[model samples]
Target: MYNSDSFYLIASWRKEECPLKLSELQSKFGWLLIPAAVLVLVAFYFLNPQEKPEENLQASLDLIQAEPPQQTETPTQNPAPTTLMVDIKGQVAKPGVYELPVDSRMTDAIDAAGGFLAAAEPKAINLAMKVVDEMVIYVPEIGEEAALPTAQPGAAAAGGAKEALVNLNTATDVELMTLPGIGPSKAEAIIAYRTDSGSFQKIEDLKNVTGIGDKTFEKLKDSITVN
Candidate 1:
């Protein structure tokens, strides 16, 4: 209810005031800046290009599922089949009747007897030979030694010196090498003679072999057998 003059004066003062109104500007824009900053941050979080969470999630799932299976240890197995006893005799360092387990061969018998003497021919015995219960195995001396190396797995320890020898009648080439003066070639000749002719009927009959002579016969007669 100002008087007309006062009202006019008041209106004119307002018009002559500074062009910029600081209070009104501050009031209107101050509230707007805060809301705008909040909106910008929210938009940036949602639309960021560097975000790839699905692959990271899948990798995490793969790591969890890729664990390997648990291990289980196995026990060792025992050998099968049974064993038996046999006699071993020969030029082996230790000759005796061995209580060997079977599925055994002649070589096994020799091994049980502590192997051969230095002069004992390795080729003298048939190693692939199979073992038999109570079978006689004979190992002969390599040379003219009295305490002869010969053995007949059974009747051996006290046998006569002559009995400690080979039986041309029943020997293989491997066993023939056990003779005092025989070797591979000479043994082969004896074998050939045996195959060509029948068994030697007597000591004199061995002379029919090409390699045999009076001297050779003397060396072989006692050692060779007819049966």
Candidate 2:
């Protein structure tokens, strides 16, 4: 009975003392806890580094630089057409050599030569034929003998009139070779003579060629013309 009273008193005293001690401790240390918590948050903020503005910009630039540039296809161009020289002679309005595109036809050459004249025998020549370099396009007149042997006087009578005759001034080597007794050498000789002496004024000028004697001239006399 006596011990119960003592124990109750002691318990009451200890409870009051504990509350006083706890209040004092809280008053003294509560402000310190808040500051310590703030310090810990500040240290954490400093330790966890944030990205720099320059670093972010550099990263963006690097990313852009890492990518390949877009490729563009280049357009192809067509090759230019080749040009060639051709001669247009005889009955054409403008008879001379003309520059033309490769694969150009005889009609093109004739057109470049100012077209054919009224007396031009268009049927006597191949107008659709392609013109070549150093080519000669001769447009003979109607009723002109292209190739005839003067030795045969009856043949001219039989034919009524002379057909289209080869123009000596404008005849090509191939065309001159078609004459009687005229080969490649003789045709070249005729071209050489014409080139050196200019246009022959008369049919007798044919004898002036090296190989063409009186017999050769007689064989080609009536068959040839100057105009």
Candidate 3:
């Protein structure tokens, strides 16, 4: 029985429905669920762990473990045993080309020249001087003017004319008896001396023997080798 012009329903009374509150507003986030699922699928697609290249890794390890090649050296060739060619000049009786063993010294070259001509200044030449291939050895004699022997007027270029060698280790009773300035008894004395001491380590050791003098030692030095 309200005013007839008022907006009202004239009917039997019925309960009215209330509007939704804060809890119901949560339903709007439901739309975001589909995109969140997509992001998760993409993340795993890119970030999943991968297997390393094991074969390549193993090859590197094998290289490190392998041993290096062993080095080998080849022996050098022995130089052909050479004869020293020496032309003896000056006071020597026979001043000619002499074929001397390698390592020959000045004094040996003089011997090839036929020992000093009595008046030679024996002390003038240093016999211990080292000689080389094709070297000329000179001996100045003191008194008599003897003509030095030259290559025979027409002799072939003698590859080497004469050869001589003295052993440092084993010259015997008569062997020691022949050195210049040495006599048989003195030779015996030399043998005794060498036998008493050990084998000669150097030709210089001969000086220690009673009979060996500066001239003698000088004369022998080039003609001998410890080996």
Candidate 4:
């Protein structure tokens, strides 16, 4: 409330007074420094941020999708069987022409024919022998004389008479082809065998030719002769 004299007196006191203390200066500015420090801490936290939970989850999903898929295996199938027509007769349960695998035996024919009859003599036949196309399998009755079973499919001559037997010693390729299961290649092979190895000495000697096994011989033996 004083005039210019009071202002002059206050200026003179300030000039003449001792310097202010460090404790007093700190007390006045400490409240302002607290708010400034809090602002600095907030800015630092925003600049250096931590990883988010959503980002970590998304990275895991991307890794799973990028992986390779598993492979599947394919299935395999078995080959079809080569078939042969066989004629079973006499004392079997049901005797007739039957289709069997090419590698079938006499026992297989008997089973295909509904097995042997009660009076059948299975001992009379070669059960373990390999059966070929058009082969005859005869099961004789008990105590009966069984004629030798031979392969003679469509082998009848004119007027119901038996066909003349093929002569392996001098038969031509066309003549050899008349026999069952003898094709052009086999007929030619027979001629080649005879030219290289002379004539067949006996019917059994025909087995010495190439491509002729016991099974092939069994098919040819009944329809061929060397004489």
My TM-score estimates for the predictions, one after another, are: 0.31, 0.35, 0.33, 0.32
**What digit string (tens of lDDT, one per residue) describes model 1 on residues 1-227?**
78999999988888788555788788868888888999999999888866479988998999988988678988978976467555545467886778777677877877888987886756545677666555445555555222222445542221112234567778777566555455667778888987889776776887787766786566556556777
Worst 10 residues of 1 by lDDT: 154-163
lDDT of 4 by residue, 1-227 (tens): 98999999998898679466669878888798988999999999999997899999999999999998888987877866599887776677897889998798878888999997888777767777777766655555566433333345654221111245889988887677655445577778899999999999998987787767786566447668888
Question: Which candidate's TM-score is highest?
Answer: 2
Q: In model 3, where do residues sit more than 4 Å from their true spots?
A: 1-162
Q: lDDT for each of the candidates?
A: 0.63, 0.68, 0.58, 0.71
User: Which regions of candidate 1 fall more than 4 Å away from where they truly are?
Assistant: 1-152, 155-162
- Segments of candidate 4 deviating more than 4 angstroms: 1-162
Q: Which candidate leads in lDDT? A: 4
* Candidates in descending lDDT order: 4, 2, 1, 3
lDDT value for candidate 2?
0.68
Clashing pairs in 2: 144-163, 144-164, 144-165, 145-163, 145-164, 145-165, 146-164
